[model samples]
Target: MSRLPTRTDTPPAKPDPADKRAAWADAAKGVCIILVVLWHVVVKDYLQIDWHIGVPVPGLWGALGEQFLPLRMPLFFTISGVFAANAVLRPWRVVARSRVAGFLYLYALWLLIHTAILALAPDLPTDRATSLLGLLEQLTITPSNLWYLYALALYFTIAKTVRRVPRALVLVPAAALSAVAAAGLLDTPGNRAGLYQNLVFFLAGLHLRPQIERWAATANRRRLVLTAGAYVLALAAMAVAGAQRWFGVWPLVSVVAVAFGVTAAARLGRWPALGDRLATLGRITLPIYVIHMPVLALLHRLLHAPVSGLDGVGQGLIVLGYPILLTGLVIGVSLALHRGLLAVHARWLFALPTSRRPAPRHVAAAR
Candidate 1:
């Protein structure tokens, strides 16, 4: 059995000066970004199964998606909620400083970048800058995958505001909100059923983080080996079924089930290297996230004819690897960028003791 990953420093109660950049949540976010990238890689060029020579494997693409659909954007929001839970009562400046500086800026900035791509690309559906729909359209649907950022920002802002409410109260309303959307009476940003799935996950993360983290700490190191295998097997089963749309009544059941299964597997004990690197990658998952669509699309378009040997199954593996690799590369680059950029904007991306220190008693009390 493999040993669980140990946090050498574990970001101290106040995370030391030298340890400022280390973040556990960041690594998980990295995993989430990889999943997002993989989702796009498979779904985009779905028609090119024969692009790979002879393998007639059906649903290889969706099988990959099915294993990971549970992972996708929900975990990211959930993790964000976990960290933000501690700071919900901070002054407005703090929220704007950290979450705004990190998440909001990324959202607004990426929105423009993607909109530009959709505008100039011949392959992409026209945004028709001159038309009324174009103006409203940008607000309605995202270029492809960028909407999650904006929606996340909105959710965090709202969650932080009334976070003082009882956990039960908060959960009930969010659940009701979700039920309304599920019933099709309400809508989310992307016009998908059960939108703000990410927000609900985020809320869950905020409330459940402590318990979840502890569970990770408590799992037997040896069990991780079996649990990891079991997780993969369970996912494979779910993936195969998902490809056939087998559950009959609920297609997304695979996603919900498998995601929980993976979350459970993380406790089996992460390899120190994998976990640490993933944590590092998670911190910059946002930029890696934005980088994925263009990166995967370009790579798939470039490799389509040449890599035809794998058929769909082979191509499926390539699709899976691209996001995982690209996420690491983009985050590696972004982490450097964050170092330089954050020095100028430290208050935005991280919390510092000086800024986070407690207030002193009133001086008039000296009398």
Candidate 2:
């Protein structure tokens, strides 16, 4: 079995200073985070509730979001891997204190928080543990919407353990595991499948850091266009052939989508206003990721009845606007709530309470 790095090993290198030009990574994260929020908005809120509006438009929105399934979380994990490459190289004591402990702490803290809040709105359409045993399951074997945190902590440990191994040794198995999970051969409960399927992308982000950085830095419109075209064509072909879940199809699709996502991020980040704003959102994605679900649950409870009772014009408006509008509202509320918690010195809600200064924004937001 592999062991953690000993203290006598070289210390972790300090991260690069935040470069305005590298806003592409954050932009990529912004695109991914928005899609994630949109997915939850469509699935958990729009699709779940009995809409006075017809299902056709809502269903269309859901399908469109589904088309990006290969992109969102995979891209997020890839960028996270890129950001975490440095941190995972540190001695066990440092990696444990900064990365592992912080993630598990937030996972445990927010697991309770999610449980308590969701308990109040049990009718809202979302997963929640109804019993102590179920809650224990979530803390251990199962994964909730908060699975990203759980996976991050685990991935860091796995990457560090295999750091001394050959690259193929780590990546090949991770890719095969992803292919297996994406094929649904594995019975992953709740969001546990994501924990299995996305390991390869994260590892790629770590192992292929130099190439990825170069790709981002040198990305141009032609490459973006080519990648986007290739991804869309591949995705469409798979969907048309209905082979999306065939043993290895989904992983290939995701790799193409990730390339497209990175290229698009690089292109988009060239625009000053958009790039800066996305970079800003990327910096705070952690808060949005953890807080959005509960906020959406509450919002669903509050708005479902009112929205369901809307008349024809209101219903029509909802069909056209519900997913995007609801996603934006949820993200806004989540960010505000995070700011409020910080103001109250409830910093532990987001991170482990330690005397060490918080990790730099890029390093910390990888989760």
Candidate 3:
């Protein structure tokens, strides 16, 4: 799979211990993007089903799966932060007209596209006056997963300040806040939301990347321990969530678990057959993530068998398993699409400009 974006690859090279961190970070991206695919594919479809499996997802099966949901996006940002931490230290001119401004440009373009689509959707909010002013106001704020981009721009802008401060010190407070969020003590504005929540995941992922890499490469003991412990804690929490929302916290814990969990899974790559499959799946995560939804939706419509309407044990499998099967189709198609023809413009989808754009000649300044 292609490696992620990093500042070190640009102009003056900085030493990136790119060996293990990059590999595992790539692995982490694969894992998170699968979780991203699953978020839409599994949960979205599963919720539509009135039925459960034999027992329920509530026990071991459901508990195991729930861990990745909350922590995935933040992990992506954390990985981004590890990269972003280096960028802002460049000259101020580079920081202003370059990094943050360029991201804002992309944000505006995408935000307009995203909101415009929703506005154009069927039977729009009639009483809710859909004014251009409101749309513009909403763009200034944030939209759906669009906040990730905005938050990332901010992280890149202020990364130097974060890098200067003790990473351990910054992470400690964030971890504490995560703990609070986990404990339901500070469950304000939703645990998955706002500036504060993302900071916790971003810092944790950045600070913990080195440690995660070391654990991945080393004696199997630590990784195994982290995985088993995370599962036990996660399942137990999910069991608790049967009554309350505390089980929601295990999803975050599971993210931590998977960082370790995949280490054991990575060993599978040593075997020629399994290894090749994993590496290939990991490689196509970017394109698959971008377009997985339309594929799943299409599959759901096409496979409108009576099984789709099943409730409980029968229902969950059909509803959930169908997407997983289709996801394989999406991945295969995305891979084939890249190889067959679309490789020419593949860069456009994973697009982010490299060099900073020149500031528009300010006529006022010229005056």
* Residue lDDT tens for model 2, 131-217: 999999999889888898888888988988899999999999999999999888999889888999999999999999888988888
Among residues 3 or more apart in sequence or in different chains, the pairs in candidate 1 whose N, CA or C atoms overlap within 3 Å are 26-282, 26-283, 27-278, 27-279, 30-282, 77-202
Superior by lDDT: candidate 2 or candidate 3: 2
Tens digits of lDDT, candidate 3, 1-367: 1123222122222223334444445545666666666655455443344454665543333444565555566556655555454455577776655556655554555555445444433222111115777555545543333455566556555554566688778876765665555555653431134444566656655566566556566726565676667666666666666622452363366455555544654444344454444444554554454344444544444444455456665665454356566556756665565444344643433445566576668954786
Q: Which ten residues in a row have the lowest lDDT in candidate 1?
A: 1-10
Residue 290, candidate 3: C-alpha displacement in angstroms: 3.3
Model 2: colliding residue pairs: none
Per-candidate Cα lDDT values, in order, are 0.51, 0.82, 0.51
TM-score of model 2 (CA atoms): 0.90
Ranking by lDDT: 2, 3, 1
Q: Which prediction has the highest TM-score against the true structure? A: 2
Alpha carbon deviation, residue 291, candidate 3 (Å):
3.1
Q: Give the deviation of candidate 2 from the true structure as CA RMSD.
A: 7.3
Clashes of each: 6, 0, 5
Q: Quick one: ranking by TM-score, best first?
A: 2, 3, 1
